[model samples]
Target: MNGNRFGRLFQVTTYGESHGEAMGVTVSGCPAGLELSEEDIQRELDRRKPGQSMITTSRGEPDEVVINSGLQDGYTTGTPIGMVIQNKDARSGKYEPYVTAPRPSHGDFTYSAKFGTRNWGGGGRSSARETVNWVAAGAIAGKILDQHGIQVKAHVNQIGDIEAPPVSFEEMLEHTEENEVRCAHPPTAEKMRERIDQYQQEGDSIGGSIYFEARGVPRGLGAPRFDSFPARLGQAMFSIPATTSVEYGLGKEAREWTGKDRNEDWEFDAEGDPIPEGNKHGGLQGGITTGQPIYGEATWHAPTSIPKQQKTVDWETGEEKEIQVVGRHDPVLPPRAVPVVEAMLSLTILDFMLLGGRINPDRLDGTAGEYDTEYHPSSPDNE
Candidate 1:
């Protein structure tokens, strides 16, 4: 419960359970005068909300976020922004069967082992449902980034065994939201949607990877060692449930690649200004931004609480049994998790931006301008 906070300068502390009265976040360190509205946050929530498509969970929670505090006249007030979304659709009755029967690949057993008890009602804090908090906070953080032309986006690159062919990030942005699977490739989206539909009928789930990218980040936003941009990004990303793999800048495959193949030199643009010729470094060099497009991929395992009969031990009777988990769950995760990944990235990037003094903080005393340096992506030298 004490570890619910993320970030140091631009902090976000979330509260509420999976089946609790409501889920919400307290966004601290956001500067005043930023135009923040409920609708702005709601737009991101709709992308993350359930029942949007047949491939995702069937549970229909409006996920309507209400800004409880820190706003006046649709603008931030330099206070802790409190936002909450009521969970009117939580059907806690369906989880009675899992009271003592922990599902595989879920946080059930590990949570119980660590806390001496677990909220079997929708996996409690371990549920991906909690990711909505991050999305909301990310919306705010992204708003800050938007002022500087920094943007984050993600798309489903694979589903189960099907992988999307090479697609341009521009094309991905243009077409990612056009499909229900949130993929850029139309042919691949159809295949992924079909695969997820098949899994849904079989009462199972599927997992896949998402390629994420962030553009317009300025250089030198992270510390050298522990607070490295990638390190902080990893901490924020793995917080989501079932994230099995996270690879950046060649990731684990770099071990098999030679320096000649992996190394990419900074090329001068037509303007005689330096620009990244390639993304072999994923826009990051030694845990810091390089003013190029930041790209990476995160893979999530299949949902754990599937309806298919699975073998588990009933702690109540200490007997082995097969039980079909009953609850609202997604057949495929990566499709819906695309926004979640981008949201976490946004939060991480914004936090680093604040930490590195790239942006000014909110001051109640009307003293706010604290320019750190002239390091900007759009600096005349880079432009």
Candidate 2:
């Protein structure tokens, strides 16, 4: 219903609904002759699709991607790239009872209040299914970034009170994909899965934090003043469903430190290059990349749909009623959100690269070159 598009030079406009025949995205401004295939996009979609593991929703959709347009002979055509994934396994009937009863912690109440009516089937446009298009478009973005050796990865950092031990970005990329929970630490992933299974059995849900890292981003890739890189990245990330909060670098914890503790002191290397002693700034200083690994976290709320009955008012009767949402949902959203967060990061960095003139927009397949500066992450003093 409007505001489906994102980005300036490299743009994506998503369409379709949760219970619709299918959902898709049309990506424009992608340069011609980039190697792209259905498998490229489908691999990422499979990660975001439901029924991956016991912790995820049971809805079984293949999430097969169909490249309907903009590619010729297995490469991009510099026009709009259209891709769709059918919703063969959607259980729209389960939502019939909630048409008039708004589920708590969901967009239903706000949407109905603004639109006067709604599709009332599978949460309509507000469903997490809308993120499928983002994953598809992000796959292309990943391809573009890969040419420059830039990598974006995310993992479940915390579920409830179970926080995993800190690991390097390289270790995360190596091990996070090993488990369905997407936690790099094997022990923590096991506990997270066990906790999620326990909650699902009780007809409830849980929420957690997801950590994201982008490596090899060239410095000077963000706009200064109002359109800062962190600001733009936050905007893109917050657009995802259930993303309640986002913080880069040390995030809210930075507030607890004094100037002496918070400031990331810079030193000169043997060659007189600036070396940061800490990442208290999260690789961005004054809204631009410092050529260091960018780290951030996003928090998600527990899914609103649950087998546990929730109290609500019947719109027609103006009387209270009890409702139990029966449709499938992720007991913990952070696992599914991993790919979504990475996609937003890709979109943000790619957009900033375009805005800052670091990458050529017209020549999408061209390289962004390299930053002269090198970043070495010293042990964080405050951590």
Candidate 1 lDDT over 1-383, as tens digits, reads 46788877777989888888999999988888899899999999999999998777888899999999999998899899999999988888988777787777677778888888877788788888998999999999988888878988899999999999978879888999999999999999999889988888888888899999998998788867887888988998888888987888788888999888887877887778787778788888888888888889999988887887789898779999888887778887887788889889999998787767777765423455664533344643222
* lDDT tens per residue, model 2, 42-90: 8899889999988888889899999999988988887899998899987
Q: Largest lDDT belongs to which candidate?
A: 1
What TM-score would candidate 1 get against the native?
Answer: 0.92
Off by over 4 Å in 2: 269-275, 364-383
CA lDDT of 296 in candidate 1? 90
Q: Which 10 consecutive positions of candidate 1 have the poorest summed lDDT? A: 374-383
Estimated TM-score for each candidate: 0.92, 0.93
